[model samples]
Target chain A: MNTNLYDYAYELEKAMRSSDEFKHLQEMYKSVTNDSEASQMFDEFRNVQMQLQQKQMQGYDITEDEVMRAQEIANRAQENEKVTMLMEAEQRMSMTITELNKIIMKPLDDLYGSMA
Target chain B: MNTNLYDYAYELEKAMRSSDEFKHLQEMYKSVTNDSEASQMFDEFRNVQMQLQQKQMQGYDITEDEVMRAQEIANRAQENEKVTMLMEAEQRMSMTITELNKIIMKPLDDLYGSMA
Candidate 1:
């Protein structure tokens, strides 16, 4: 596994969170369960990501620049935190997955053929 | 007037670029001007912002974390840099501006009245 696997995982997670299909499922779950189970799952995922990031940066001393940058990030997150937009974008992109896969087919096959 | 004016300006610029109204304008300009004047303007704006940020950070030493963070940002920008989505989001939000303004009217009036 590549060191970038974590990055890929993160992107996949983000993509799933942003997807229309996922949103529809979430809405369905909410209606059926009469509870925000999907939303709670998202919060759990975010908490895990935060914990992972905190653990990753454990030994590093927080600098003034980091403090300023963190504050800026927090401010932006608080102000324009549109999780739905992200999900919607993912949904739009999900609809194109087949097209994307078709576009990559030749290159992926070639790469696999070469390795084989 | 405010230190945050730049942020607001940046958001406005982003909003314009993402808007269907603006995208149509851009396509029209490209078709007529036979040049991507709108896109060029956006590039110039981005360059100016970069220069301003560089000037702001002049006295400070760039830390390892900054370097890493910069690389991460660059990679993400390269991969999923959908300027269209940002513009679309802006367009979507722009359409709701009147509604947003209506929502904020009372709070704004209260603040202004207090200041007066």
Candidate 2:
């Protein structure tokens, strides 16, 4: 109920916006958006990720063919300048968020500890 | 790739640990952990949530019986003092995290825009 938490959270959000990770991510994303070829490549990459994630959630194992197909797209994505930059920027930002999540989850972790 | 982001993130993490919301959530969680009945009730409430999530992920619509059972457990959770406080604190903290996530995803949101 205290507004102090919201204040601190908002402050952090603002800080994230000003951070270098967000800046580079924004730049790379814009580069990809302006290029149709790059945009399509990025989209395909994301689709593969989503497909893999869906299969994982359904308790289904991905086939070797699917893995090879995904790898092919990934290799292609990495070869494209805009797509490569965008992916790297995305990973950088994602890593920051992942680290932040661990910090946020500390209390629940404490509760689960041994039981988890 | 920038160290400054890490510095800001760690600063925010430290602030979160010192925030009233985290402190209150910690207290409530500890209270529930120390109480056998309260912990059981909290666990049951979480189980219902996980069950619903699993069903939804599997593309299944929950039956009315399942809905009623979930509601029953939820009602009991709200009635339990320890569970109530812990849940409230969890929601309060979760709201902050959700808001933060929006800020973190701004670049991706911009990239997807109408396509999303």
Candidate 3:
């Protein structure tokens, strides 16, 4: 079995899931629900989640129901553009990580397959 | 009628959900499901998504099923650490957006509540 990819993925997944950045984001998102400000903040988080999910789904098979849900979620975070902008910025950073991972992996696959 | 908070939240949520960064992440995530390289990439995505969801869920009411789901998803992307890393990176980016939203909203809440 090609445990190479499987093992590599597992370790990487562990690192990502455990990273401080990931943990922090989790904390921040939860923070949104803690107080009045927090609830407002959560509204912002929900906005970004909805926006990213919607746009990324552009030519994909996302259902109408999903789109509606996204809209409903977005409506909850509408009052502050500043908060919305901040949320957008963070989402971009997360997307960059995805790009970075792919960039690193292509060569390794070539290297491993050659050895195999 | 303290929709000041509710309205504000709705708009911010809309913005976050609609932002370019959010859209981009969705696109990148879906890209992983398109081909072999993409699948390897997807496993990485699963890792980050799992990590973010799990970590963000800290002190929250996440269930065992969700944790198991996250781990299972992480395993799929184990073939490529690079992909896993990228996925993690993207998730962090998404999470930062949440933080930024909170920062921007707190003051607004204070100002609005005072007005009321």
Candidate 4:
């Protein structure tokens, strides 16, 4: 077929962004970033998240101390009203991305069978 | 709107999988894995790739020695006929994914503007 996979993927993304879910997410994100305190809290929370994700990806075990520290920062970040709303929006987007990833990874699954 | 973005995404995935690009990729992958020598070489190349990516993501700079070592491994991996075909397939897929990501991140781009 002459169809380009990238073209289809682009259309899919356009459809996703046009949804209410994406609009709400963008609004919530704007609200969060507009507040300086909330923005700082978000930055700190994201730094911890990146560090933890990096450690996990490298196949390293996360220390209990690091986990506790991350939890503390996360709890603080979640305590803010705007941050909480932003997180709800983020959660929905995260699920959508997960679904998209499953779709994208089908070829590998087909190739590796149960191993994938 | 009552439309679920997920449904559209799934339809798009169906379209992608049916494209010649995906078919050729699958065929190339099958040919590569079917050859034991090529499979071993591919595995080695992927391991090095993983290590270098992990290092880079952790904010570590690649030393001259590490770059040379990776290049050597990649050269050997590219020399195999089936592996070369698989790499071509993977490159096309990579470009497709990059386009998809750009679309998916539009909300963030709108929020962060130039910083994004």
Candidate 5:
């Protein structure tokens, strides 16, 4: 088989690393980490978020109280300047990834539509 | 800003193209296209699937009858040898893309914990 696909994968990886969104994400990450309070808040928020996801993925029902608490923590974290910046950067990176996925999957999409 | 992310995206595209799953998908696509009957069946299947997706995306509820009809078409299409090969190939390709997406999104995953 040809090595073209692997080569493209490597190139795509490089591009993602150099993208503005990724760079901004890294920068915001450093900024947030430099602030002890912001870092702690972000960490707590992340923990709560992960637990919720794990529960959902495991097919466990999350209580309304748990959901509310998680949202509250996220809201508090967002109030922090560093956390807000980090989130925006993260969103940009996410959008970039979504766009790239669409481009990369075009062939499959054209051939199979949304069936896959 | 750095261009790393875009570069990575390109590399990833290359890798996906060169992957066995992708190559097989292409080959299967070619085989199905060469057979008129299979190609027609596949085209119809794709059309139905796309229509359903569009409706769902538009927030329209798909009636039970529509769902059953779509499933029937899919079942009939799968019975064709060429269509079956194409579907299998597509499944492999979809799996490969999913895996690649996971790998590419690791950093974001760790940082945001699925919040993004």
Candidate 6:
């Protein structure tokens, strides 16, 4: 197989890493990890969030109580400066990935639509 | 910023491209594109699919008629051998991307869960 596409993928990855979003995300991650309490709280928040997503993906409805509980955890986690910064950084990084995925998937999208 | 993470991202991209799923997808893509009729049908299908996705993303309710129309187009497109192969190939490619995205986003996912 021709290696040009693979080479391009590597280049794309390098570009993504150099992006401000990824850099900021890495910085925020470091800051958050530096604080033991904040890091623990973030972990809790992440666990709750993951459970909710898995439930939703499995076609299970999340109850109002569960939503409230998750929101409560999130609110508390966001109170930490590092955690908040991490959240913002995470958003930026996720947006970057979404954009990259769009571009990367275009040829497949053109051939088969967004069905995938 | 430490360049290690970026280097790893590049490696990940290279690995994705070298994956069997990606290889088959590229082959199918080439085959479909070589056939003019199949390629044109695929384009039309893609256009309709994009429109539908945009509507869904915008929170617009798609009418039953629209769904049926899109399904009709899809059915005809699938009748073409190259188109069918392309669709399968696209699915495989998309699956590889999803897997890669999961791996690439692990740190972010660990810090923030699957919220993104």
On DockQ, the candidate that comes out on top is 4
For A16-99, candidate 1 gives per-residue lDDT tens digits of 444444455455433423334444443444454475467444534456665565555444433432443434544554454433
lDDT of 3 by residue, A57-87 (tens): 4424556887776667665564545445445
The share of true interface contacts that also appear in candidate 1 amounts to 0.00
- Candidate 3 residue-wise lDDT at B16: 41
lDDT of 2 by residue, A48-111 (tens): 9999999878767789999999999999988999999888888888888888678655655764
lDDT of 4 by residue, B6-87 (tens): 6766777777677777778888887877788998888888889999998977667789999999999999999998888888
TM-score on B-chain, cand. 5: 0.89
Candidate closer to the true structure by TM-score (higher is better), 1 or 5: 5
Best by lDDT: 2
- Which residue ranges in model 6 land beyond 4 Å of their true spot? A112-116, B1-84, B91-116
Which residue pairs come into collision in candidate 1?
A: A18-A87, A19-A91, A20-A91, B18-B87, B18-B88
- Best-to-worst order by TM-score is 4, 2, 5, 6, 3, 1
In order, how many clashes per candidate?
5, 0, 47, 0, 40, 0
C-alpha RMSD of each candidate structure in angstroms: 19.4, 4.3, 18.1, 4.8, 5.8, 7.0
Q: Write the per-residue lDDT of candidate 5 for residues B1-116, one digit (tens) a residue.
A: 34555555655655665577877888888899889899888988988999998876555678999999999999989889999999898777767666667656666666555333
Better of 2 and 6 by DockQ: 2
Residue B77, candidate 5: alpha-carbon lDDT: 94
Question: Which tens-of-lDDT digit does each residue in A1-116 have in candidate 5?
Answer: 34555445545655665566777798899898889999999999989998988776555678999999999999999999999998798777777777777767766666555334
User: Residue B81, candidate 2: how far off, in angstroms?
Assistant: 3.4
Query: How well is each residue in B1-116 modelled by candidate 2, as lDDT tens digits?
Result: 65655565566666667777778878888899889999899999998999999987876778999999999999998898999989998898788667656764564576457455
Per-residue C-alpha lDDT of model 3 across residues B1-116, encoded as one tens digit per residue: 22232333334444444455445544554454445675655745555576766555442455688767767766666556545644664665446444543443333344334423
Locate the minimum summed-lDDT window of 10 residues in model 6 chain B. Answer: B107-116
Per-candidate DockQ vs. reference: 0.02, 0.28, 0.02, 0.30, 0.25, 0.10
Put the candidates in lDDT order, highest first.
Answer: 2, 4, 5, 6, 3, 1
TM-score of every candidate: 0.19, 0.69, 0.30, 0.70, 0.65, 0.58
CA displacement after TM-score superposition, residue A9 of candidate 5 (Å): 1.6
Chain A of candidate 5 compared with the true chain A, TM-score:
0.92
